[model samples]
Target: MIRRTRHVPQIASSEITPETVWLNRRNLIKAAAAGTMATTLPTLASQTPDLKPLSYVPGECDGCAAEEALTPLEDATSYNNFYEFGTDKSDPAEYAHNMTIDPWSVEVSGLVNKPGKLNLEDVLSGFDLEERVYRFRCVEAWSMVVPWIGFPLADLLQRFEPTADARYVAFKTLYRPKEMRGTRSFTSVIDWPYREGLRLDEAMHPLTLMAVGLYGKTLPNQNGAPLRLVVPWKYGFKSIKSIVSIELTDQQPKTSWQELAAQEYGFFSNVNPEVDHPRWSQRYERRLPSSLFKPNRVPTQLFNGYADQVASLYTGMDLKKYY
Candidate 1:
C-alpha cells in the first residue's frame, strides 16, 4: 500500500548535497558486474521474469539537439511502463490502442477569465507543434531519449487567460475502467485518475511541452495519445498523460504519487540524487537498450541534466522538504 509521512520538515540548502552537479560516468562503469537481479521490483516494472542476469556494455550519454539517438521506436513504444493499462511495460502498447481519443476534449477551469471545455480540435486549432528531442528520466532509475512534438503549455493557458490568482496548474488523466479492462488491478496502491501539477512558472516554461506526437508521427495510445505534458527536468510521473481536466489554482494541488506515498514520492519529485528514496539511492540510473552483459548504469543529473534552464525556478524553497 502507499505510505505517507507524518510530517514534512523543511531543511536548508546547506544541508542538501549537490548530487546533481557531478558526472559519474566512470563510477557506474566500474560497478558494471555481470550478475542476476533476484528481487521483486515495483509495480512500474515490466511483468517479465524477476531474476534476469543482465549482460552488455553500454555507450555514454551523448547526442545532439537535447536527444541521445532517440531510444528506438520499437523499444520506446513497446517497453512502456504505463500502469493505466496494466503493470507490465508492454501492457500499454498492446492494450491502449483500443482507447478512444478523436472525440476527446479537455476541461479548463479555476482562476481563468474564460473557463470552459474545449474539444481537442479547438485546442490544437491554431497552436503550432514543434519537435523537440528531450531526455526522459523515470523515477524507477531508468532513462530514455525521446523526440516529442508539441507546443508550449503556456500557449494553451494563455488562451483561457489565467487570472493573477492562478499560482499552480493541476492536471488529470482519463479514467475509463471498461475500456481498460485488463488494468483493473485490485492489488494496486494508486488511485484512479492520476493527478499531477506544476508551479505557474514551470507550466509557462518554454521547455515544458504538451506533447501530441512522438518520433515524427502521431502519439500512440499507450504514450498518452491526444495530449500529454512532458516536463523533461522532473521525473516522468510529473508529465501526466491523457489529460482530461486542467485547472489553475492558488494553492499547490495534491498529486497522485505524493498522495500515495508522501515520504517516497514528494511533491517536488525533482531528479535529485542527494535526496535518496526510502528504499534505494537516486544517485544512479540505467540507460536502456540493455542485454545480458550491459544493463547500463550511470550517474543521474540534477533536473535530469537541464539544470541550466530550470534550476532557478526553486530559488528559495527547500527541495528536500517540498520533495
Candidate 2:
C-alpha cells in the first residue's frame, strides 16, 4: 500500500513547546550569561571567533512538528558524522575546532558557464539567508530535528548557469592532512576528501539547502562549518560537509560510499522505511539522546517525512532500485 505524508498545521508559538522545557532553556541561557555553558549546548562545542547568530526567514513547513521538543543543542553539536576528525560521535566536537575555514573557497567547474574558484564570502555576499527546521534522519536509524540556516542550493547553482549537459552535481569535502585526524588513519576504510552527488534536478530542488549555520549561530566546525549540503529527504551522509568543490557534469560521478561498497550504498540513499539496510531494519529510528535501557524507537517516515514535497521528483523510478 502507498502511504501519503501528512501536513501538520501551523503551530502557534504559544503551543510550539512545553512551558517547562522553555523555562529550562531560559534558565540555561541565564547560566550561559553567567559564564557557564547552557545544559542544552552541544558537547565539546567551541564558539567560532567573531561569528554572530545568522538571521533567517522560515520555509514552507516552518512549524513542522513544532510541538515536538528539539534535540538539545549540546547533543547535536557534540555528536556528528565528521570522519575527518575521527569516527567517534564526540570526535568532531572535540577535535574540529582545530581546523580552519576562514578565506575558504569552492572550486566550481565542469559543464558550468562560470568556472573558477569562488570565495565563500562572495558567494553568499548579498544572498538572503533563511532558517529551515528539518528532520535529520541518518542511515544508522538515529534522528534529530535541526534548525539549519542557509539559502536554497539552487540559488547558488544558478549563479554558474549550468549547461544542458549538466545532469549531476558532485561535491567534495575539504582535505587537510596534518590537522584532520581521520585523514591520517592507516586502518580507516573511508577515502579522504569525501565525495557525494545528486541528480541535477535534486540539486536544484527548493528543499535542497547549502547550510552555513545551525540553531541560528555560525555553523560549528564539527558540524561542517563554513559550508555543507543539506538534502533533507536523503540520509544524513548525502549532505556532504565542508564542501570545497562542486562539479556539474553529465556523466554520473563516483560517490565515496558507492566506490567503497556499491552494493550497500546507492546514489539516491533516500529515506524509505520500506527498505531495510543490509544489517538492520530501517522501519524505525531511535530518537537521539537515547540510552541503552531506553531506545526511543519511532516509526521511520518516508523521505524522512518530506515525501509529499519530493516524491514527485522520482516519477517512474523504483526507490528500492535507486536506494
Candidate 3:
C-alpha cells in the first residue's frame, strides 16, 4: 500500500538555481576552455547520444525541507563515492565515462513469480516518472539536496510478484574490470560487484525510488547512469548505483561495505545522528559546495529528516544495535 501522506516539506524556490542560470554557467565555462570544460561541465547528459531528457512531473515525491539548498549539478556529479571507479571523490567524474550503459539490462531473479532480464527501455516504458527533491546524507558526514527523477520501487517490485518466502531484496552493481578501473586497483578492499540489501517492507516503502535521472535529465555516467536506487531516509550508500541485478532472498544479503568493515557499516544503515560512525561524528554534516571559509555545516537529523514518515519501520528495533 502506497502512503498518501502528501504533506512532506518542499524546497523553497529561492534555494533552487534557475534552469537558465545553470545553462548559462555551462556555456560560459565551455567558451573559456573547450577542452578543460568538456570534462568539468555539468552538462554531461549532452555528451551521451543515447541519453535523453526525461519527462517527469516536478515536486511530486517527498522528503525535502524548505530551508535546504539544492546542491549544484557540478558538485553533485563531480564529488561522488562510487568505489567501482576509484576511492577518490573526483574519480567517478573522471573515469565513469568509460563505462558502457546504453544497452543496459537488469536481471530479476530468486523467489519471484516472474524472473527474467528486463531492458532499460522496457523498465522506463512501464512507469510514469516523477521528480523528487530528497536530502541525500552520506555516512562520511556530508549531505546534498537533490532533485531525482524516478518511480517508486514498490511499483517495479510488484510487477515481479515477489513470493511469500522472500524476506529481503538484494541489489548488485555492474562489474566489468576492463571499464571500471577501481575493480583492479591494488588499494581497493571491497569485493567486486558491490552489493546492498533492504528488508522486504523497507524495499516496498513508497519513499523507496528506482532513479534513472536527475536535474530533469538522464543520469550522467558518474552519477549512476541508466539505473540506481534512492532510499532518502537512509544514508546515501543504501542507494546502490549502476544496478544490474536484483534478487528476492529469504536472508539478509551481505552488503559490500558490511563485508569490508561490518563494525562501521551495518545492514540497516538508517540515518541516526545519535549512532556515530566509528571514526567520525554523525551529529553534523557539511552540505556540499561548501568551502573551508564557509563550512555550511548543519545538524544531522534522525532518519535524515524523514522520521515522521519512516520511524514506524524501525519501531521495535534498536537502531544503534542494527547500525
Best by TM-score: 3
Candidates 2 and 3 compared: the better one by TM-score is 3
Which residue pairs in candidate 3 have backbone atoms (N, alpha carbon, C) closer than 3 angstroms, thus clashing? Answer: none
Per-residue lDDT of candidate 3, residues 109-174 (tens digit): 998999988899987787888888899999999999998889888988888999999999999999
Taking the tens digit of each residue's C-alpha lDDT, what string does model 2 give over 159-278? 889998899999999999887998889998988789999999999988898998888877888889788999989999999999999999998999998998888789999999998989
Q: What tens-digit string does per-residue lDDT give for candidate 1 at 239-267?
A: 99999999999999999988898889887
Please list the residue runs of candidate 3 whose C-alpha ends up more than 4 Å from where it truly belongs after superposition.
Answer: 1-50, 59-67
Give every collision pair in model 2: 41-74, 42-73, 42-74
lDDT of 2: 0.83
Per-model TM-score on C-alpha atoms: 0.79, 0.85, 0.86
- TM-score order of candidates, top first: 3, 2, 1
- Indicate the residue-level lDDT of 207 in model 3: 88
If both were scored by lDDT, which would come out higher, candidate 2 or candidate 3? 3
lDDT comparison, 1 vs 3, better candidate: 3
Report, for all candidates in order, the number of backbone clashes: 8, 3, 0
